[model samples]
Target: MTSTSARVGGIRKEVDAQKLGPALLIASSLVLAIRTARWPATSDEGLANVEWQKEVEHSGHIAKAMLSHLISRYPSLFLLKDVPWYVPTDEDVPE
Candidate 1:
């Protein structure tokens, strides 16, 4: 019984860690955007007033990083290696 409880506790810790990963990513992205925005503009800073400078670029990078992290960490989120794209479901069958 102790072993079973210990196993379940381990699984719970792993699940909690997985949930924390995305939260950390979002918090870090916000910190990065704020830090970059607070930097003083230089004389050669081009298009200082442009909307794109307002964290949009950082958001794009963050999105890509998040996607890469998720794909690497949870490859099973995709189809099996040998599964065909044209595999039919119940909806595809004639009623």
Candidate 2:
């Protein structure tokens, strides 16, 4: 019974460790999004900055989509270089 309990405790610790990094990342992303959303845009330049930021964010989404495609469709492209280990090879892209 103690051995079974110890095994369960070890698994719980491993799962918690795995969850911690992604949880921290999500928290940081939320903080950054909130900070950006709260940015003041009083002047004309500030408004332009906001527009530019919007465009930049759109481009970022496109870039991420393209990257996902490249990674999923052509996994061999990263054979020579170190690819992100977290990105699963079998990740499906929408048709």
TM-score, per-candidate, Cα-based: 0.30, 0.34
User: Candidate 1: which pairs clash?
Assistant: none
lDDT of 1: 0.54
Each prediction's Cα lDDT score? Answer: 0.54, 0.45
Superposed Cα RMSD, model 2: 14.5
Worst 10 residues of 2 by lDDT: 5-14
Off by over 4 Å in 2: 1-48, 79-95
The per-residue C-alpha lDDT of model 1 at residue 57 equals 67
Backbone Cα, N, C clashes tallied per candidate: 0, 0
Candidate 2: residue pairs that collide: none
